[model samples]
Target: MRRWLVLGALLVLVLLVLAPFALIVLNAVKTPQEYAGSGPLSWPSHVSLDGIRAFWTRVDFGRKLWNSAVISGAVAVLGVLFSLLNAYALGIGRIRGRHWVLAAFLLANLVPQEALIYPLYYLARQVDLYDTRLAIVIVFTAIQSAFGTFLLTGVLAEFPPELLDAAAIDGAGRLRTLVRVVAPVSRPTLGVLGTFFFVWTWNELFIPLIFLISNDRQTVPVALGVLQGDRMMDATATSASALLGIAPAVLFFLVFQRTLTRGVTAGALK
Candidate 1:
């Protein structure tokens, strides 16, 4: 009876989570006339591709995809590398003032982007990095790395002393040990971090909207958002936009599903 109840509860939870996406899919296929007649939750009489087509063309979605890919991918790779190096120093090297450093990173993660936007905007103007993909990559890399450092440091702190001793016994220095021993041991965690950084950076709207002013450099989220004005927006198009914005992120999660699962479960065992 308990097992049956648990299964029933899990099924309910899954549906609750998927309800929003299901709504997007449902409404996205309906024509504007059908949508107006039947409302958002009602099934469409026939399928329509107008909203998706219009959105895709208006935003040059292919280029937006490429721009987002570049920025998110660069931030993911750079964030993981920075996180590993910082965690190695704080956790393995046991450097002086490590706690203070970790505290600072935690505080950085706590600081909302709303507060930093003005400063970042001013700095970008000064550095002449405004309206560039590089600016997005650099900013998100730092933000993601700060959180990654917090995660990785705790894991590394519990790392086995025997492994370090073995590496040192074989004449491996700190950097060598990190390269040869620590990183391999932490591969699952790193994959998890990279996947997270990629998706988080990909979904970012505010910073990219402010920094990437030019249509040519705009990301998928920003470009789609730009299209949603009184003239461009309609109920069907809004539904399509929600679906469009979430699709790539969902696809990325699916691709890295196994890695994320492994990382989440890595610490489960003794």
Candidate 2:
């Protein structure tokens, strides 16, 4: 009875999570007139691609998508690389005050981006990086690295000591052991960090809105915000753009789904 109840609760939670996305997909196919006439939850009588067409033609979607891809991709790759090194040093190396270092990383993660945006903006402007993709990429990488270090630290800490011992006995130094041995074993954890950073950066709007003053330079989330205001009366176009904005993140999650699961569950047995 307890197991059945748990399963039923999970089913409800899943439905609650997926309900909004289902509405977006359903409404995205409707014509603007039909969408406005019918409710957002109502199914369309006939499918139309007009909303999707308008989303592409009426907006600089390709450029926005490319900008988002560049920023998110850079953040994911650079953030993971920095986090791995930080975790290795703190989690595996014989360093003094490593616990305090880990605590600092966790504290950095706790500091909300909203609280630091003003300082970051001032610093970016002072450095002549304001309103540039490079600025956002640097900010995203730093923010994501904090959380990544927090996660990867635990994973690296749980790594078998014997493996490192074996590598050392084979005349492999710290860098070579990390590259040839530790990295191969930590692929699942790395996948989780990369997917998380990519999706977070992809969906971020506030920071980009504050920094990227030009519409042409903004990310997809900022572009979608602009689209929402411009197409307030056109529900179908809004739905279409929202769906388009999230598709890449969804696809990325699907591709790395297994690895993410493995990475999250790895510490359970240890």
Candidate 3:
């Protein structure tokens, strides 16, 4: 009876989370009038591809999609790379100021992202990287690395010192051990990190909005915002645009869900 009750509660929670997404996706295929007139819960009497077509054509969604993919991918790879480097140092290195360094990192993470954006934007301009994909990647990487390093550092701390010590005894260098041994065993953690970086970078809005002013270089979130202007708000088109925006992140999670869950649960256990 307890198990059944728990399952019932979980089912309700699932519905709560899924409801909005279902509404968005379903209404994306609906006509603007139908979407506006009908409750989100109502079934569409007629499927309409017009909204998707208009959205894609009006905004050059393909370009935005490509831009988003490139920016997010770069952020994910660079974010993970920088994070692993920091985590390995803090996790295993015998540096003098490890605790202070980590404390500083945590404190920095606690600081609001909004607080850093203006300075970061100015710095990017000074460095001749403003409005470029590289600039976006750099900001995303910097913002995300603190938390990523925190998680990766915790995972590495749980690693048995003996394995690293044995590798050193056999003449394996730090990079070798990190690549061959530490990384292999840290797959679960990496999965979690990758998923997080991808999702965050994909959905990112504020930074891109601040940096990229050209439509050709704009990300999906920014491009989607353009659909709502002084003239009108095409609800169906906006919904379709949103669905397009989230598709990549959703697909990534679906592909790596098992590993992601394992990584999350493993970290929880630790």
Best by lDDT: 1
TM-score per prediction, in order, is: 0.96, 0.92, 0.93
Position 248, candidate 3: lDDT? 78
Candidate 1 residues 1-270, lDDT tens each? 999999999999999999999999998888999988889989988889898887778778889999999999999999999999999999988899999999999999999999999999999999999899888998999999999999899999999999999999999999899999999989999999999999999999999999998989999889777777546578898888879889999999999999999999989866
Best model per TM-score = 1
Compared with the true structure, model 2 gives a TM-score of: 0.92
- Pull out the clashing pairs in model 1: none
| Model 2 agreement with the true structure over 111-209: per-residue lDDT tens digits | 988999999999999999999999999998989998998888887888899999999999999999999999888987898889889999999989998
- The runs of at least 3 residues in candidate 3 whose Cα sits more than 4 Å from the true structure, single-residue gaps closed, are 36-41, 267-270
In model 3, what lDDT does residue 140 have? 85
| lDDT score of residue 115 within candidate 1 | 96
Off by over 4 Å in 2: 1-9, 230-233, 268-270
45, model 2: CA deviation in Å? 2.3
